[model samples]
Target: MLRSGAGHPDAGQSEASTSRQLSPEEEAQRLYATLNEYLLLEHKAQPRLCLPNESENGEVTTGARDGAAHVLRCLKVWFDLPADVLINAISLFDRFLTKMKVRPCHVPCITVSCMNIALEQYAADTDTKRSISVEELVSISQSACTAGDVIRMSRVIVDKLSLVTGCRTSTVLDWLRLLRAMLRLHADQCAIVLPPSCQEEELVQLLEIVCCDAACVNTRTSELALVLLYYKLEQQLAESLAAAEESGTIPEHAYYLYDFARQLQLHCHMCDTTLAHARARVRHVLSRYERCEARRDQRQRLVWRLSERTLKVLRPTDRLTSLLPTIEEQHFAVDATPTRTRSGSESSENEETSDWPRSPVLPVYCDN
Candidate 1:
């Protein structure tokens, strides 16, 4: 979340400080060059995941990814981790899933392990001790895996992907920060006052939400950032128009902002139609994630359907039947016959004769 405008002007700063370090032409050329460099880096670093179609495994893989994204988002917020860490974690998790075939049952363990890796990598850069231990992470995530399991999974991820987790990966937020700075520089060089740019915090949060979409794993970082940026711009414009009409006056900087958006498209070499489609897709997924989050918050209890194998592990004798009285015990209260001898050999013929039906009854007892 570091500002991309290190040497450039910051928001709310006077134009005097902005200076004339780069002319309009120079600024445009620089933006284009920077876009090219990011394009290459994004190609090399963006995560890839192929989500199964609806016909596959009841969409278990897709659900796992989307679920992991949301959980990681919450975990990031809880840990107060930087916005980029969530992206890095999710990217690593999805990439690992893409590299191998993972069962749905193991997805939670893998998700938590990926979060641990992301934290370790990010913690190194921050030079602080990790507040959450491996055991704590497992417990907090409600993962069935133990600390050792998470640790082992982390090693497996490192080995399978061969990715160096020592440094931060280029994420969508990085692209957005750079793009926003490019826009600001463009405005400064053109001497055209545009509306106050979108807030970085809001943009970062929105980008994080957008990443919850499983489809986003396939999206290039540059394009995803551009879509979010453009969506925010459009949203701002609409609000401005609404306020302007109410005030009976056209908003200042409207035309300038519109032109600036066009320049951004051109600088990024994105076709207008393609950009619009992407914006629509990003908005749709954002809304979907929001709705789901709302429902999640309103949930009164944990409601999940565990598979049969998991049920067995959790409920020995179904965890309920073992406590209940059998029909004979409930009705007759007869002393139970011992099924095992002192020698530990079976003493009840019925117990060893499971291969035969016992309910046909004796010929004398039945109406023949």
Candidate 2:
């Protein structure tokens, strides 16, 4: 967790009065350094989009990333895991992909393993409920990975990144906490009411939704949280003022709009122009997501079936089938899509990996 007023101390009445004597510039500078302490978790490390091996479809990649994230969200809701688990899981997933090469077929496995790792870390730190076992996770996610695969992948990820690194990096939640405090302090200074209508859970849910956007993968969490709050508060303020006008009554937070942004920018070191662009991007992404959601809702009412040709090739239970090789399926098969090494030679899975049940006479994996 990002400690508030980190590396700083509280003061008594006399000391507090002395602090009040500082100039505005000095105060802002002091607060800025304190706020920036939240970003101590490798701020230089940014996670970017990782394309699947030999795949060119950007839509598929986006869909895959979003789809995987949605799986984590569902798991969180299903298991009643803390919000930290979901955010940390997504961080692990993004960072792991950014740090290594992963095949498209392995995406589901990788995603689940990341979630499991996060869940374990969270549970260990908080001493909460035990994580879902590897077998159950594979079954629930329908990720097609074997229990062994999840274990191996989890080990690989942990070996690559430290356990705390996922949560150590500032997340949307951390930024939201900081911005909320700043907003509250500014509202008090203006002698205006704070947000009366916005609930904490609502704000949390909105930020979580915003984090789901592909654009946010590498975007700064602080800016995303700031803009999200800015838009929400601005909307609430407008609504309150309009209602107050119609009702001939003063609304709570009526005067809170005065110098609303000064402290946020000064304390958080934000650029107005950059924030504006990020807010626009987030707005566009949400609009697009809502439209997609509406379409999905409509489609849910209708029965859509695969084409006869597709059904002929795909079994009804194909989605539920495990992708892991069984004893009979473990013989070395020629890579249908061979990858090239830097030496410019074709490399295939046939180039010895883990010990497998071998059959010398025939290919275990039938492409057909």
Candidate 3:
């Protein structure tokens, strides 16, 4: 929710000073270089492994991962932690798990420990106090891991990962921040508010899905983030175009969004050769997204059909009767002339009425 020049007291002044130091183009170039360096470092730090090797005995399994992911998601919702923190924690956990063998029994302790480390790192970055308590972390775990257990695990994780306490590694979040800054900078150039900040939560949600897939385990974080952003922007653009077509008018900011999407696509294609394995993983993520959407749509359609049938059944039969004319009423109205005969002729009149004007009765038979 924090904007570049909002919330913080000196944000505007700092941004102004920073802008004075470099042009937008130069700033973008610098960010690109920094992100590229981070990507290289990430690749060097952990190379991709084959899937069979990754799923060896003592390694984490799909079921364990799903359980851990569910716990993390619950913690995020319960504690109101930033998406960035949860993502960082997951990243760190996965990296550590890749190096060390972890049993299902040890997952909860390890998960909470990684989250604690991520919280510390994030707090250090933003110069904010740690908000979560040991009790809260322990309560979120599936197993009864005490604060002492979490502390010991944290230490082991830090030492094994060689993680510096105050410093955080460059992650997908960093890439997202850079992308937002770039879009904001360009939007300023065009005198528009084309910030992609609104999509941050969506991007994080997509990343969560991608992270769970086994194919994405070995994919580079930056590539995953970029591909996610690429698909997200494409979806947005498609929706915008449909709306514009209906309205017969397009917003000026639409062009800027489209341009940014194109840039994202170009970045993906340009980096395709270097991150060749990532393309398959990205495709897998997209397939998962599509399947999720399809299922959601299918569920909605089923509900709609059920509701429609219920409405039909609940409709007033009297109203339908009033709308439709019956055969007896039609025959009486058509052939019932005034009878001035005596009461003795009433029986014969009734007998004649039965055979009189059978044409109206034909409609009842046709209706049946």
- CA error at residue 343 for candidate 3, angstroms: 91
List, residue by residue over 1-368, the lDDT tens digit for candidate 3: 12222222233436767557766676666555554555555553342433243455666676576567667767877898887688778777777877786676788899899888888877876779998877778886655789999999999999988887555566666666555555666667788765354356666676766765656766666666666655665666677789999999977676675577458547644465645567666777668778888888557343333353455466522222212434564344566776675676468757645544322211122554
Give candidate 1's root-mean-square deviation (CA, Å): 11.2
Best by lDDT: 1
- lDDT, candidate 3, residue 3? 25
RMSD of each: 11.2, 18.0, 15.6
Q: Rate the local accuracy (lDDT) of all candidates.
A: 0.70, 0.67, 0.65
Candidate number achieving the greatest TM-score relative to the actual structure: 1
Worst lDDT run of 10 residues, candidate 2, spans 5-14
**How would you encode candidate 1's per-residue C-alpha lDDT over 1-368 as one tens digit per residue?**
22232212232133424665655566556555656666655655656677775536644567678888888888887877787678878888877877887877888899899899988876765568877788877887887889998999999998887766344446676678778877767667667554454778888888887788776667767778888777777877898889898999985676665677677667667777767767778878888877978899677897697676665676543323212334564443368755644545655674545454422221234566
Q: Which ten residues in a row are the worst by lDDT in model 3?
A: 356-365
Worst 10 residues of 1 by lDDT: 3-12
C-alpha lDDT (0 to 100) for residue 57 of candidate 2: 49
lDDT per residue as tens, model 2, 1-368: 33333312221223556656754455445555556676565363357764543457432376678788899888888778778778878888887778776667888888889888877866665557775777888887888789999999899998886554323455666567656655665665667666764556777787778766677777677777777787777777788788889999976556465356555655567788888888888888778877988888557466667674565465443233234455554444576654545544745554543444332222257778
Q: How many clashing residue pairs, candidate 3?
A: 0
Ranking by lDDT: 1, 2, 3
Ranking by TM-score: 1, 2, 3
* Alpha-carbon deviation at 235 in model 1, angstroms: 1.8
